[model samples]
Target: MAHNQFELLKQRRFLPYFVVQLLGAFNDNVFRQAIIGLLGYMAIDADDKALYTQLAPAIFILPYFLFSATAGQIAEKLEKARLIRITTAMEIAIMTIAAAGFVTQNMIVLLVALFLTGVQSTLFGPVKYSILPSVLKPEELTGGNGLVEMGTSISILIGMIAGGLIFALAGAQGPWVAGIAVIALAVAGNLTSRAIPPVGAGAPELRIQWNPIPESVRIWRLTRKQLAVRNGVLGVSWFWFVGTVLTSNLPVYAESYLGGSPTLYVFALAVFSVGVGIGSLLCEKLSARTVEIGLVPLGAFGISAFVFDLHFAQPVASMAQGLTVGGFLAQPGSARVVIDLAGIGLFAGVFVVPLFALIQSRTPKGELARVIAGMNIQNALFIVLAAGVGIGAQSLLGWTIPQLFLALAIANTLVALWIFTIVPEFFMRFLSWVLVRALYRLRVRGIEQHVPDEGPALIVCNHVSYMDALILAASIPRPVRFVMYYRIFNIPVMRWIFRTAKAIPIAGAKEDPELLRRAFEEIDAALADGQVVGVFPEGALTRDGAIAPFKNGVERILERRPVPVVPMALRGMWASMWSRRDSRLGRMRVPRRFRAHVEVVADAPVSGEQATAAALEAKVRALRGDAA
Candidate 1:
């Protein structure tokens, strides 16, 4: 598939939908904050302010229960771009009314705005996800969805912080300013919405769902009908469940436990967001354009371990002290202690990105929109569960914030163990650790232990340097065939060695179609004959010594063979003799003794369902023991 990467970000396609979705999030937070701020200033004779605040998220989630069933169906059948325009326009009107309510200090009106924003989001739900499959290829879906997820999360954080600031800076009249900002955003969103590439209706003339509740139930039932649908939804819902737990409780922890100010709030969020963003991008860098579900379980472990440590780490600094604005930094080892939060976010990137791609790639064409709708319902329910846990821990058990962190960590571990045990691919991979403790030997982890001994497999590794393939071929007991770039196949000195190893040659799709054709035919034959084939998915040695996006040649091969994909991570090669690690590629070369420690760790054969480059890359990153 051609990379329309720049075009994907252009105003006509992805930008419109991004703007619509982002502005909607912005408006929702703005109106909610306006209500909360107003409630703070005017002491109404209501039952309890805390009570109302606690219930706010629940009220917002209610619409998912009420409208998502039909909304997804509507999204599948309606013109997506037009639907976005409608939603944006609705936000403008709804926010206008919210502003009026704020002016009159009407609590009831403000609450209505919360519910209305939920409704608007509900309507946009199906359209947002369904459109991606239309615009992207299998490989592009992971990066595309990753960008969207990261962007959406950042938008939410920005909206929340900005909404509060808008109010703080302006006072009672602050909400009016918020409303104006939202309205302008809403208009810009609608304009962009109109420009999106046309995505046709999936189920044209499908019956309009008059009853949202029963219909919603019907779709939830549909999700449970298939193993793929059920497991995929469960995996996706876990992200929300994990997210809701952290976001809901942190503020209270910052206030009462840390005795922290708003600055601390900003710091905590920034750390988590940056960590997750880094993790998500690493997926692309490491996976080399494969869906690396192996990272999902890896993230699960990190989430639990770090969160557990955070639990133990917290009470020490927090025992007698309240966190001040300065305390965010002042606490001893505060940065490391926050690893749990960052790990949680980073794992979130690992966990969620592939699932989104999986859903897009796997969902039935005509039902893709409805499938996303099903996702929204489950996601909402899981978030509600997260809030419930936070509330129950806080109010019923009188649990402290750090204790809640401990509980969440334990729960995450158990859940991961259960999931992996049920699907041995993840567990089996973990069990395959080969601890050859020889100082001269390469000690491999994760992959070598997990790769199936039987069947034809394609091994993909990031091309960090020229020696990457040679090192992997030498270590793994099984003989492997390598697909190499034509340039390296003819290197003056390395050419004979390449021929002796029987490496395949590849050219650009247009550069040498005949060569590509022969390569494809050979790959297909190798898989059919149950041979193990290895390829430099990164296409060439990393010039800067970083991972590169995978070439489509591998994807095209998969479309033909659909064989078990064995993702391998070759570590220590960057420093090895045949590889380049610095600007001085050949100048300050090290001796062969320094290269003796290089290792190749091959992970399990990723399933066709989860064999995406992003998924595979995450697994390899862990194996490489790099920045991840």
Candidate 2:
């Protein structure tokens, strides 16, 4: 119930991790940009500069492909806190070697340093992400990721500036400055890692594997076992690919396409990074602090739309030569380009944060690190493929950068459509989120900590409106199966959604005895499989604005399967357009624009043996109180 994420920074559990990650990100950028700057401008002769600069990035990324599997295994097999400390120590040693490379002005040594730094990051990757779920509660995961992402963006921006400044001002002393700065940051990171609470290994008994390729393949196979987790990982990897395409081409886009200077390029990066930070921070607010997968579709749409728009936003009048930062900003139609870039990053943040949270929450704890390792490998592969696509399009096909952006936007659309089709639950959740947000101003209380995060349970609620099931489905963080009257469940407009949610539809025993019997059997099967099933104990929708008498069907369900029953109440929905308060035509007269207040309060769980139909009806009425 904290108002903002900043309060997390004041606590020991999150603060130390935050500081360590921020510092690590800053160090990575500082060393990388510094090395790239030296290779591009100073250390290498003009003839060889291009080759070394191109080689630098490859060297940095190679470890992810070669060692991510082993790194994942290491994280799983060792205590996380110790692994973090060891990774931090490795960082210090790597930076020291980098400093020696800088001092001796040896390009080979520096490249080796880059490769080793990449290895350090490869090892750190699994630990950094896997530690989050252990350290933060389930509800806190999204917010924590948002903060880490924001810090990383800002750190990269600052590190780039610092690297640039060191190269410019330190002159011959640049190497020493870079070396000292990285070493100091590495030490600080190590200290911060020390303060992290102890985290035992997730898979301590697992045997270590030395072969990288087969191990990588094994882990990747494991990752693909879960459809949702696989899609989420693919989505995350695709984001990196799109990002690589954009970032790899930005300088060319600035200098050649937009006719802009280094200042202008930096300005563009700043806008994009800041936009991502803002969007990441906004996820908690938009989803009401839940891991709302609905935001993924929205974000994908925004990214596609803005990227497509960027193709047309290019200026008509060519400058023929690059412009100064200020000159570029002053040009006509430049604002649109800036907006497009920022929007791409903003939507990217929205797209990425939830997938990470989803992967963490859904993956088994034993395989969490290895799955993350697989994701890293996929991300690396995608980044390389993105580079290949960029090269083939621009060099082989003669496409302009704007043309490439358009192509990527189209590709993004296809990828999103494909993923959504493969997993319709994502689409269903998106519709549920939009529907509830549009019609009602919803307030949910006690579900965060009270509702079992994983288990079988029964939810008993007053049947107030046709929207009751939809509202509960949207509000609860986990998937829930609903038991509803066969007529309502089979409504032509809503049947598909009901089928998608796997809601069990029942008829009166006298009317359709077989259907009622099958419904109860299905409910029992669902509970046996550890799924939540929600039942409106009233057996039918309330005809008047009062709680209907609870039926004995709940008693039968409890007798069949003795699980905990949660009592809930719906308030302020009786007069909503979905309710049957007036004539059918009268109810549809005027649609509420939005912001109609409604509240769903869940009481503590009661034992199934003790929760009689009358007692539950009375409990729901008390929970509803004066509102309805």
Which of the numbered candidates is closest to the native, going by highest TM-score?
Answer: 2
Q: What is the lDDT of residue 276 in candidate 1?
A: 75
Structural RMSD, model 1: 12.3
Q: Locate the minimum summed-lDDT window of 10 residues in model 2.
A: 586-595
Give lDDT tens digits, candidate 2, residues 1-628: 3445777898888888889989999999998888866664464677688778778888989999999999999999999989989999999999999988877778889899899999999999998888888877667777878888888888988888787778788887887888898899999999899998888899999999989999999999978989989999999999999989998888888888777877777888888899889888877777776677878898898999999998888763246466887788778888898999999989988888888888888888889999999999999999999999999999999999999999999999999999989987677777877888888899987777566777799999999777899988866766689999999998886787787778999999998999999999999999998889999988888888888789999999999898888888988887675777743764653544235688888888888778788888888899999887
Which residue runs does candidate 2 get wrong by more than 4 Å? Answer: 1-4, 40-43, 316-320, 587-594
Clashes of 2: 0
Predicted structure with the largest lDDT when compared to the true one: 2
- The reply for model 1, stretches above 4 Å from the true place, is 1-7, 45-47, 315-324, 425-628
Report clash pairs, candidate 2. Answer: none
The per-prediction tally of clashing pairs is 20, 0
lDDT of each: 0.70, 0.86
Native-vs-model 1 lDDT?
0.70
**TM-score, each model?**
0.69, 0.96
* Candidate 2 C-alpha RMSD relative to the actual structure: 2.0
The true-versus-predicted C-alpha distance at residue 320 of model 2, in Å, is: 5.5
